[model samples]
Target: MSEADGIVYSDVKFTRTKRNTRGTTSSEAEPTYSEVRILKTHPSTELPGSQQHPVSNGGSKVTPERVVIVVLSALLAAAVIALGFTSLDNMHTKQSFQTLRDELEAVKRNLTERHCEVKSYNTVQQTSPQPPVVKENDPCLKCERGWEQDGRQCYYFSIDLLTWSESRDKCRQKGGDLVQIDSRDEQTFLELKVREKMKNDGDMFWIGLTDSEKEGTWLWVNGSPLNERLTFWSASGPDNWAVYNPDGEDCVMMGKKAGAPDLKCWFDEFCKYTRRSICEKPAETGHFTLQCV
Candidate 1:
């Protein structure tokens, strides 16, 4: 409009105009600028005393609280490690004890088996075999020359003889004594051997029967006394005195001839007779023919 429309305006008037921007169109007036009054501000008021300490933004900065937490965590970790070691040690100790117990049980089982085997062997040895006796003339006979084994008994025939005491002593030296008959089977066996094998010579041979050590009490040299029931003493034989002096008759002789069994008294001075005499012993239980060491 013409300058102030012919009248001078005293108050300031503001006019606003708008302009189009790149993609926006505007149809408005521009705003007028005006002066703004600011109230007076007292000199900046400072904190009353010392300056505040600065704060840092470093991400890794350590604070007192954080240090305390870290220390506590370290203690926890140490406790955990100690507990683990204790458990492992306890397990190891238990394993060692179990191993020792197992070994002891195994040893006990082995010992029991060995004892059983020994008992079985002993039982078998008690039930084996034995040997037999043979006639003197038989090739299998192991008796002294001119001797015969009948059943369990052995007999001999004498040609050159001596006093009964001498013959008895000689028989004892060869691992035997003059024959002593104890059982019916033994007596029968001896009588048969004499009948079948003796020479017809009239000489009498000493038997094991003797009363020398104690008169009237017959005892075999082997220390077994003759039982009265098994004796071959002739009737009224062994009378305290005989063709010899009053010293009780101590020895007995049996002749090959029937009815010639007699008790004889002899002096110890005649103990060196060179007569064939019978030597007898109970056959050992097993393998009677084989000699035992």
Candidate 2:
């Protein structure tokens, strides 16, 4: 017969174990009772000719609950791995953000420093006094209003007549002095200017040259004496004409350059005569070689 797995219920006599008493030294039997397991084969109660499939230990598989538990465990493990990667990515992103913040702060610091430097430079420029700028191409300064510029000199022709001394004071107030005829060019120019303002006969222009210091010794305002050889006398002039004052014709003038009597030459006249005057000075824009004489 084929072996079968089953439980059989049957009554059987129980056995007793023998034991010895410690004091009396008498032999005695101990009663024993227990439930036991036994292997047996049983006949099948199925109908004759019925078909059935045999199952082996290997074929006995896990239940639905156990399968569900295994699946859940696998999903949990995958989720844990994904979470670890996510945590690493988050940590890396935080590090990058911190680095960016630090770089931005550094840039801000640099900008602030640069701004401060610029401000400091501006402050210095504002506090310092700048020297006059000389024009590169010319040694003449720029003429102020009411003055005319020529080469390295600026000229001013006065309309209101004033005494020679008074005219010189006026010119000084205007940042200049009476025109000194240093050359023929200068003399010619003054003659033209005086002619333009004359308006009639006997009108004159006072120059800076004067012999007021002595009877016949002519000196410029700068204390420089005139070169007699270079003198431009009108007709028989520096005759110390005394029509206006016998105190003597001390001041010099360049009269009419044209007319029945030529007047383009120098003539001595009274220093007190009120007449249009010319002012001359070195140009303000560049180095003057004339020493402002």
- Candidate topping TM-score: 2
Cα lDDT tens digits for candidate 2, 6-115:
65555554656554555544345554656565766666899899999886768667799999999999999999999999999999999799889989976864553343
| Clashes (N, CA, C under 3 Å) per candidate | 7, 3
Candidate 2, clashing residue pairs?
141-283, 141-284, 141-285
Q: What is candidate 2's TM-score against the reference?
A: 0.49
For residue 74, what is the lDDT in candidate 1?
Answer: 100
Error of 1 at 184 (Å): 1.6
Candidate 1, residues 1-293: lDDT per residue as tens digits? 45334443244447765666675657676667665444443555777785877787666877999999999999999999999999999999998998989888667545433322112224444643332344332222234444565543455544546666666656666556788766665555555555454566444456777777776677777888778766665555666554345454566655454444232121121123334455664322222233212
RMSD of each: 24.5, 26.7
- Global fold similarity of model 1 (TM-score): 0.39
